[model samples]
Target chain A: MAQLFYAADLFGVAVFAITGALMAGRKSMDLFGVLVIAIITALGGGTLRDVILGNHPVSWIRDDTYILVASIAAVGTVVWVRLTQPIHEKGLLIADAFGLAVFTVYGTEVALQHELQLSTAVIMGVITGVAGGVMRDIICNEIPLIFKKEIYATACIAGALVFIALRALATPPWLDTGVAMLTVLATRLAAIRWHFSLPRFHLLDRD
Target chain B: MAQLFYAADLFGVAVFAITGALMAGRKSMDLFGVLVIAIITALGGGTLRDVILGNHPVSWIRDDTYILVASIAAVGTVVWVRLTQPIHEKGLLIADAFGLAVFTVYGTEVALQHELQLSTAVIMGVITGVAGGVMRDIICNEIPLIFKKEIYATACIAGALVFIALRALATPPWLDTGVAMLTVLATRLAAIRWHFSLPRFHLLDRD
Candidate 1:
């Protein structure tokens, strides 16, 4: 029997893909480049998780639905971008936060299933969720925000811990996912609102 | 006894890490960010291989030298970047290509050791060699050249195929490694010099 979690995950994946496509449209990339970014934004996290756990067939490759959903969303986003003129830079950050939150919960849930410890699951959650964004930034020849002394990845980690806590309290799975996503979103929003940042810790002297 | 091939691999890894640090330095990333990029660039390919193969103690985690070498290189690169302002972008690309060639041959060798078929070995080689750059580019928030109708990955595939053919002809092990590395370097250099690009395949309809 298919569960509600699966449905939310599909929604998350679609939105992430759309966000990626919209972002790519800001550049002069061809359709394939847009598609590649879209796929990375949507499915890259789960791919990392599966690879880490040594799972077979890969998550998206196992069921074609993920790819199908992302492709459709990508095409839709491309159309939307062209019609809307240009994607707003500020709005893009908000959508990216949503993607990170949803993916963090899903990643943690998957890691727990793999018998990884709660701490490891939480780490994996943040890593899988934000790592795609990190990768996306790197490919674009920009230093990732995570390393830019931003409070970005910390929100994902905090949210993941919230998810684990709720699950431990016997919270319904839906509530857990929602709470986790909200935690991430709220933390991220607050960070942006207050310009939250992690203090730089430089081990070596830099002139 | 560790052979010349082994020594070359170490040298290539350190060089790759230095190149990665140089790329990160372009953005004035803090020391940690520079170090992280360099280390990831150096270890990313081999780590993917070990994870996919379910090899215990993922490559860098097994040998302290990989980490030490990459770290030293990263530190050196950062220092150089500080001493010399505004590195040439082309220099980084050439260094990256050199690293890619080395890793492609080594990746295929590892796959062969795992008794994988030629096609699988070639695919693995390409993945190991190019995924790091793809990951780096994504984190930098740029459209990866990998998906940009480029001949970068194609060169790796061609070089891998050459290695397989030579090995099948009973070439000596060290000779095979040397031949493969040289072939990869030459092919990549040619592609870069000639501005070689793959045929653009567009599956998306224009809006």
Candidate 2:
């Protein structure tokens, strides 16, 4: 189970790197800029979570494998995109949905391991799921999609809530993780398919 | 000396809070939004530095005073702006400059005390100085001013370098800090006054 989770985590990192590199390409950034953005998009969320939790040395700094994987994924993205056509947008979104589900479940587990309060743990899970994409959009000078886009963060929150409830029922670890990830993936995919979004709250004042 | 530094740090927090509130006002955000942005702006850089350095509890979390000062300052700006004239843009810039200088020097000191390498210390100092503003701008969905504006980060780098150089020269603590702060302030003000800017870097490719 541990080995499977580790592999999925690396896959999530690579998926996020591809998304980041694609965004950088749109901005006409050079290869160095693309790599930097890709790495940040892949590792920024986990790094932020570990930092906030006071986990020392950060994950990537402690284990070089994470950085290596993100880098190779970014470079591979550039090569494939240049040699062929841009990745199909729908395919990219499906990949991202899976990545988000994996990270959200993994982050909740990490927070629970550190013995954080339930509410804090759920928040941390959502942050870990969405923060890398948030940072990517911010660096690219766009409002974070989570704020106004489809049910992105909401899906993460749902998954986190499910995880905590399952933990309370003392379910097996693998079953609990699998169920939570599926919850997130289903929520996100359904939102994507139905084109549904939460209503945006905006202040009403004439400029 | 410690008391003085503490007071200065709070003052810096207040300055950053005001800048954040002003930016929020420009975006026509409500009071709650303004306060959220202000708190993030005032404490974001320090929080990031502490987290990255594995300093537990974070500065604001450890000391409620930081959050209190930031909140009060943000509210004060709203009241002042609504009751009277808006703050002069130049005045706001100058206050931000001082805040940046203080944070940079303080961040460098914190990193050094943590026994980090000198180069890493310098990088931390610069990050601490400018990261809050970068975050503020990003949240507001704008390109960070440090990326293309006057010698903002350059000034921070200059101060960090000066701090390190003086430390090696065995300068007194007070002298080292005072001189470094002055260096940043002078460089930043000169840039603002002279309209000097670093050359913008852009890749040339026909779309």
Candidate 3:
């Protein structure tokens, strides 16, 4: 892989690590739990991608650098949050949005590299992006964001489409990746910012 | 792959479908819930196996036979229980044992065919065997079987070792699969029946 690709992968890992740490902070979990979530969030999506694609040594086991970086980032986030600007619940959401975008793009690229079909790659990307968070939430005894919200997978889906479009339009792969990343980030953030909600199925009571 | 393979898969589906339908029955749910769980239990493990393996068209989606058999069995079991026997919780442990064993063997074979090393193949098998139940329990707001007492993954690990050992001993592949299956079933059933528990640990608490 190019140095640029490696940089992007590491960047995504750091972003997710911080994001998981931030979520752990919100729950007021101990430092260990904070670190655990951070490690899981950073490693989770890529691990899924590798396992699904039958990539051996699994990705983290192959490189191990990613886990190292995530650990440092997670520990740093916790210390930084404690020492510097106090973090609020809303702050965690912002970090989470960034984390979500990174994983979605990262996962899509991994799937494409493995030569999955366009649609399957897209679906797998979304699954990789969301499944980890779903797991994090389940472990924490919270409802998964994907199952509860309107726009969770929607953002990943849109970003994946953009990715494919860019590729088809003969754009440079890196540029396409950037566009996909930004599109997901913007869509997800905008949805939350505007309090946008999709139609909900309602129930009627019998008299 | 083989006639016996298909039969084992079908048996796994049928048993688990009945198990799922029976659980939903205890919930006094509508027929929809019963059918959904039945399908989930019957199809869930293989669906996950294919997804993780990146095998397209999933198992049931490819052949359609598994789904049909599972649905018929599910409906049949629910009706039979409603008309005849009481819904005994005793059957759940037995059904779970059967499903776990069958899916584990099936997953191991699929991963091995994909040329994964024995360790990765075994991990895939265990994950495939357990993940569906974890998913089902999560959706139903129950703690996952993976987190429950009674040596779940340990049982699978042991059976997978038996499979590997037998194969290494030049046991006919078919016979190896049978031994593995029976080992898983026996181990899991014995664990449940004897109320066996693995020692739990929390790293923080340990210190």
Candidate 4:
């Protein structure tokens, strides 16, 4: 189980790094900027979770492998985009969804192991799933995609809730993880397909 | 010394919160959004600094007073803005400079106490001073003002180095703190007054 999670975590990091690098590319940022954004996107979410939970020696700082992987992924992205057609926007979104799913489940498990309240765990899960992208968008000078009338964070929230509910029912670990990931992925893809979004916050518009 | 630092920290939080709320007002964000941005701006810097250094129970988490001060300041800004003329942009910038000075010194103090390397301490100080504003700008969907060839972070870096230098030279605590804070405030205000900026990074402009 640990080995599976480790592999999935690295995969999530690579996908997130790719998204960040692509964003930097869109902005025509230089190589150093691209690498900075990529590492921040891949590591920001998990780092925030660990810090909030008071977990010492944040994962990447304690183990350099995560940093190495993110850097390689970022550079590879620049090379690929230069050599071939840019990644399709649709494909990018799908890849981001997978990263989100993996991150949310992994974050939830970490929070649960820390014996935090279920609600906090769910919040942490959503943060882990979406914060990197939020930071990426912010650094890229755009409103975060999650804050825009999107179903992105909502999908993570749904998955987190489902994961907690399943754990309550004493479901097997593999089944619980699988179901939770699918819940997030399906919701995200469905939202993408249908172009549905939550009601926008139009508070105080009567200026 | 500890008491003085505590008072200054709370004051810094309140000032930063006001700046955040004012920014949200300009964007016409809702009240909840205003509060969220305000709290984040006030606390984000220290939170990031502590997390990066592996400090536990982050300052605001360990003490509710920080949150309370930030909330009150945010709400007060809204009321003040609604009842009176909007704060002058110059006034706002000056206020932000003070906040920046206070946060930079306080963060460096914390890092020094942790016995980290001097370079790390300087980096942490700069992060603490500017990160909140960076976040505020990002959430408002704007390129961060500091990243735009401004001397913002540069001032923080200068102040951090001064603080470290003074401490090494066996300066008195009061003198060290005052000089460091003044270095940042003076440099920032001078930049604002003289309208000078660092050279712009035009890396990779070739299409």
Every model's TM-score on chain B: 0.92, 0.94, 0.92, 0.96
Model 1 regions more than 4 Å off: A202-207, B1-46, B52-207
Q: For residue A110, what is the lDDT in candidate 2?
A: 87
The deviation in Å at residue A170 for candidate 2 is 26
The residue-by-residue lDDT of candidate 3 on B103-130, one tens digit each, is: 8888887777787667656766776687
> lDDT for each of the candidates?
0.75, 0.82, 0.75, 0.84
lDDT of 2 at A24: 66
- TM-score of predicted structure 3, chain A: 0.90
Residue B98 in candidate 4, Cα distance off native in Å = 0.9
Q: How many residue pairs clash in each candidate?
A: 22, 0, 0, 0
- Report how closely model 2 matches the true complex, as a DockQ value: 0.14
Cα RMSD, model 2: 6.9
Error of 4 at A146 (Å): 5.9
Which candidate has the highest TM-score of all?
Answer: 3
Give the Å shift of residue A206 in candidate 4: 20
Clashes in candidate 1: how many? Answer: 22
Candidate 3 chain A has its poorest 10 consecutive residues by lDDT at A24-33
Lowest lDDT sum, 10 consecutive residues, model 4 chain A, at: A198-207
In order, what fnat does every candidate score?
Answer: 0.16, 0.21, 0.03, 0.16
